[model samples]
Target chain A: MSRLNEAEIRRIAELAVKQLEGQATAANVEKVVHEAVQRMSGEGAATAARHERMKNVPPHNQAKGQRIILTAFGANSIGILAGLTSELAALKCDIVDLSQKIMQDFFTIMILVDAGNSDVAYEQIRERMARVGESFNLKVIVQHEDIFKTMHRV
Target chain B: MRIELPEILETIRMTEVEHFDIRTVTMGINLKDCISDSLPRLKNNIYEKLMRTAAEHVATAEKVEAQYGISIANKRISVTPVALVGDGYYAEDFVEIAEVLDKAADNLGVDYLGGFSALVQKGFSKGDLSLIRAIPEALTSTRHVCASVNVATTKAGINMDAVYLMGKIIKQTAEKSADNDGIGCAKLVVFANAPEDNPFIAGAFHGVSEPDVVVNVGISGPGVILRAVKEARNADFPTLADHIRRMAFKITRAGEFVGRKVAELQNIPYGIVDISLAPTPMPGDSIADILKAMGLQDVGAPGTTAALALLNDAVKRGGLMASSHVGGMSGAFIPVSEDQGMISAARAGHITLEKMEAMTSVCSVGIDMVAVPGDTSAESIAGLIADECAIGVSNSKTTAVRVIPVPGKTVGEEADYGGLLGIAPIMPLSKIDNSHFIHRGGRIPAPVKGINN
Candidate 1:
């Protein structure tokens, strides 16, 4: 999972507010976005190869926006195709890859992030993110970067 | 390979959860009568018995496993009680017998060997006393050979004498093979009213009623069960029960298939299938994770009993439905020392022996993976063993204890059994001795007096 900067989290909040408006269920959209953004911390995968690759990329690279598609199901239905670029806007977090899948009752969001360490309080953020999921009636679980790597390696 | 989720569910209909696997195929043989005053003759007799019975055990196990597509996780052997066999023997004689047992297991392709045991809860027999004395040497001198000494029971109090001996023996065994990674102690176990027909090794023994050459199995699948649980954590309690019941059914079916096949391959009659959920050192420790998933921070919480009861009951139901014959300690293992997760919880002070015993009430086995102070008296040890056995006998289920007493360690210290059985921090036991009660030797009559089951 990629780490996002405060500005990137703020930008995500602004976009989510703009795109969803009422579609965003929570009264505090920024809190939800920040929480979601914080989840994109260190990329924990099966191997350290990606971390090595992320290290080589210029920290100043700003134009490289990545796309992420997130879907929320279960509690709600939602689909988001997000466009993000150079991690500088994301506090050195480069969105290398992202995917989302939802069935009738379960929602999963997978992301690959190349950013600074994103470890932060997740519970309060999780509450904010819950509103985004509530609007769609989806139970969304965002997995970090390297988790999918080791998860699939098994 | 991806099909519509609903379509897949509809197509399969998830029919009655036919997920079956083999638990274990234990070859139990009587070795007590094999003991002789003459050391060489005793060794020879043991070799003849085990070699003759278990010669084809491995090949047969493989053939059966392949034929059934069910994983037979453990291939093991249990013998007559060591005390019964080594009656009136010296320490050297006991060591000699242990070596023969070890050689027999190795040659037979058995991964784990059991039945280095002494049942002296009520009182020590002539042989029981000798066997108890010989345990430290027997365990230290041999590999793959396991040991157990019962010191107490409900009917009788505790055997402080035996308890003291055991404390010293555990230390000696650990120190003697400290270089072999102290792997010798892992092979041994202690118990109260130890079952003779247990298919699980390091404790299995051939009961007097057992057929001369039958094969039993101890099926283990905590990993498989854990996966099922993780998949259904969000479901409600009843739904979870349904999921668990289905999972258990599949596991038992697999066990029965493997056990039958192994018996066929070995040309012996297929015995019972023990559908026990045994944990390994893997990430998904069935016992620990199951507890965690049940909403407890760890396994020692108050909810532990209810959760364990459900697990044990579901396993038995599923196993009984799958196989006509089911025996052994077929329940969840609470071996604190053996499970890495348990070690973590214990280290964090989230678990205790009392809570462990509480969970044992619901689960099949009793207080496992416990390490005690080296100075604990034999009588006190006997008392503890008796209390555990009383629970088993009164409840009409099997219960046993396998405690390790690390010499020179006080409560809150660590004794590293290492590799598989794992390490145990010395657990505190009440310093009070119950030797006065243990000194009174009288058999607690079997619960079999009832007319109907």
Candidate 2:
């Protein structure tokens, strides 16, 4: 019964811009925002309940910057990147940055993924990524990037 | 905003390769309010409080460990010294209280519960007398309960009466648990100037001044520092100190991060990050190895104390810079049975009991996890503890004795405690009698205030 607040509207607008990938027209922005509002309102009670649940979680414990860092270690092989990317795409996780190195027969790939817009939980994302790692016979480490920042930064 | 690839990889390498882990996340609970006139009510109150407060400790630690990819070696609990809570209880009642604590620790899934303790540095109350009497039986009856008694302080001098009593108690504990290599003695620590917020077991206790409940962390990374020391082999002392400081800073930061996160999740105040480089029995993770890497021929060489002083000082200096809240005995721990290198040194007869005693002067704690001969007399044990207490009193620092007299085990034999408690080589002890000196059991007056070099 309550209308969206300014911050919520701003969050929606920002998510829409990220989805549009710089091809934002006024009409397109309006249409995306309209769709999102309708979808959210359709799940009004559930969304409000989730928000209430989230209020108890301290901000720092949440995904820092709404992102996670995934590091994979395994033997050099084909379809590793394709398989991982497809799974991430299916989960609506955006690959913000990625780098890979192959030393002799072994390979180490580090990917920074943004899961802000994904509907899934952080634990679910980590579990799903673990499954993908298992499928590729890789040892995948999915950690909230906040830990690295806490240790390596200050 | 971006962390480089090398930095990320280095963090991973520290945990995955170097055996870097949070030594323990110890929750300290105050039991003063759980006291009651009825023994049964007191026992029930203590059990219910511990169960309710620490209900989520293990689960929270697991979640944090999984999230951060860093391992928490042990989850533990420390309570307000039971002697303070059970003031009117008898020794038998105290033993029953120890049983409740043991059961609570087991049900909570914590490895150990400390603070079955008494502070009689100056003198003992009636309750302290009861708790002291109960120690051996309490330890023998329980698996997870640990006990400590503070018998000296810089200001209070040494309570030789308490010192002599603890020696007898240690002997009784060893004899009662004789089948398990006198393991009960391993769980009892006698201290001079014990730290209130220490997170390590067999010594940790929630001090009188502490808040009702708080979470404190102990950091471990001997392997990480050993690697750094190896890499800086050619550097001079100052440069070497810097390398150690930087490494200590990183590990302490990691510890503080984990501690704060755990406390946040538990909704309790985060007490401290004890930056002690506690070593384990695992290969390459040892304070002795770090000393050897620091140019010592072996741990017991002539310069062993100097090497330990340097390592201990550098750890404290670096750790102080890394965390805002630091407390406990934040110095390099050299538990003989717990550190593999120390065990090797003992087995080789390279590190003698005398050398280890001298080293405790400059280290965080006194001679720890030492297993002497079965026939070692109680007076000799009292003499040894008094010696360490003298060092602590003179230097205004903390010291302790966790010596075990393995029944039927002597020099050239080893007490195999397995897993974390590790193996202890029965080191030789001097046979010269100190009965006359120890039997004069009055208090040693407090040392002169500062200025008497």
Clashes of each: 54, 0
List model 2 lDDT by residue over B396-423, tens digit each. 8999999999999888999999999999
Each candidate's TM vs. the true structure?
Answer: 0.65, 0.90
Q: Model 2 TM-score?
A: 0.90
- Whole-model lDDT, candidate 2? 0.92
What is chain B's TM-score across the candidates, in the order shown?
0.84, 0.99
Question: Candidate 2: TM of chain A?
Answer: 0.59
Where model 2 places Cα greater than 4 Å from the true spot, the runs are: A2-65, B450-453
TM-score of chain B of 2: 0.99
Give the Å error, residue B448, model 1.
Answer: 12
